[model samples]
Target: MQAVEPGGVSPYRFLLVAARLGSVRRRSQDVDMIKAQRVEAADSALIDPAGSEWRSAPSTRLSLEPTPLISQPSAYVQAKWETIDYGAIGNVSVQALHNDGGIFFRLQWNDATENDDIRDTDQFTDAAAVLFPVKEDAPLTSMGSPDEPVNAWYWRPDMETPFSVTSEGTSTTIRTIDPNLRGNGAHTGGAWAVVIGRALQSAGDGYVQLTAGEEGKVAFAVWQGGNDERAGLKAVTLEWQPLELEA
Candidate 1:
């Protein structure tokens, strides 16, 4: 198939040509474009869906990270990083649900050692975060730029509740803790299970607004204290995952 020059042929002819010969170069470029344009998807935390309930919702594993990444605290390169043995947490199982005017999430993970106590700078605490875009087309990585911000729901066992933050690039500011946002966690049998809940909309400025039947994107990150995986040194999804609310 011969690649059609833009403006020289119609899309119909472009498809017909692509089907007939499908030039290797053109086909390869098309595939690349598709990947670049397509954002990966995941099941949104359900809203009052019936099943085993929030605690028993189906689990989805998230295990992807940035290439050539560095740990924020240690400044270790991706290949040489020893904490979590270079993304050793493997994957975290997650489930989400909403009820009584709020959305809830259950994140579970297995760790041989639990680092819940964070009393010193040398020691780090186990933590996780979920980031949602303030706007439909907000960038998942970089926590969105200034013009495009993101709302982050962060949880740690040491805290009585999760923290709501708005971020642009590397700059983040603590925002009002929405009365509707709160979460708790427990560690048992070398594993951790945490539940976080928040309203379906942004509480105020620089927050994402969630609604039933709406679609958006979310990103996940996890830090292992035992491995000194503090700051930027953590496991994270490489790209945005689909988030769609059920009516």
Candidate 2:
């Protein structure tokens, strides 16, 4: 165990705290002092069970070392994975490289579960979505009808999928779609996407809100929760295409 830093107040200075959270007793319970005193802004970091690789965080001096903080041989294998609960809003995207070598991008949306004022039940009830492109600062339009809840519109993208689903009840993949089908978070606020085919984050791998003022060269197809009752992608192929800018 490392010596604890005194009176830690800054969120970024939190590397001073260390906890071997992997340890838990099946027979008895123990209080983890490390998690109790964490100064990091997000609790998800210390507890992400799905983190297969060690990652260095830029905000703090801490390096999320290979788990099994204790020398016990079985410790690493015992940690429980945390489930990710994310809400969806219909997403718009852009995906082509400009002739000048700069990438173009765009997007807009509203989440059904995010806010009381903005939460629209059209999705969970009927599997619907909406789109607001950056061009007009567009208003929310239905993904389908409120009763049926689905429609198809092309948002351009710097389309690339790092992996493919290779299982039943799951047909998920990507294909290059259009150009000038631009959209992004510049109008909203904090956002993250694959810009110009690169994973971007306003703050490291985070998708907070979108800002229209901020544009990028990548676009993503955000699948709504209701689309997969099986808890995974369950379709043939997610359609994508090259959308040339309109003349």
Candidate 3:
């Protein structure tokens, strides 16, 4: 074996460097490929915060692409594939409006199938979620770290109401369902529109409080029941988009 020079790089270090570079390249590509979308102040605020009033509101549409989940699989998820092909949902339209002390969001997406039944492990139901960082600088991927938690609002057609979930690093815990966290969904003409809303303040620990005119970040995810998307096998946004509340 050849003698090594002082301060010379090791093979392990070289591999780590290559991995980091690859990640940066992928991120840059995503930024270019993904078209970031934003919500504007509605002409008229939602008449019913959790209702279909958003249909009349102007929409901000965003293009969504399938996530390449390359990280090590968690115990709850057995699949180790880098990408899942669910005939990917292409885009989603979002609308937002705020009132006396809360904010509401409406998300619409097109799906060829309507999967509302969840009867077995193999059977999955259509679902969607909106994520916000507890801390302003929290990581957007892998939920979030313990120090930088993420508040997730999940909705399913079968559920009467939406529920909140918190994620710290790789761990996730379901929070109590709040009546104040209201949601209404409708599926029509091969599409689904969901309206969800919550108070401007945190209901408890592990929640993100929203305020009017304050800047925040958000991300979205969708699970196609017909395609067998469950757990970490769903399509997701590659990065967080800016969420600016109306004053």
- Candidate 3 per-residue C-alpha lDDT over 158-221 given as tens digits, one digit per residue, 9 for 90 to 100: 8988888888866465666775677767788899887777777857778788877677878878
Top TM-score prediction, candidate number: 3
lDDT tens digits, residues 28-119, model 2? 11111110111222222222212211132111111111111121123332232112222223233222222221212222233332221213
Give the per-residue Cα lDDT of candidate 2 at 246.
17
The lDDT, on a scale of 0 to 1, for candidate 2 is: 0.22
* Tens digit per residue, CA lDDT, model 1, 1-247: 1112225333334346656864333423122110011112212333222223654444566653421243232344444553334333555766766543556667778877788888888888898887787876676546677888878888877887778878875535465676667777777788877777677764577877777655667777777777776556566664566665655
Q: What's the CA error at residue 39 for candidate 2, in Å?
A: 43
TM-score of 2: 0.21
* Deviation (Å) of 156 in candidate 2: 18
Misplaced by over 4 Å in model 3 are 1-56, 75-84
Model 3 Cα shift for residue 207 (angstroms): 1.1
Candidate 3 root-mean-square deviation in Å: 9.8
Candidate 3, residue 244: CA error in Å? 0.8
TM-scores of the candidates in the order shown: 0.71, 0.21, 0.75
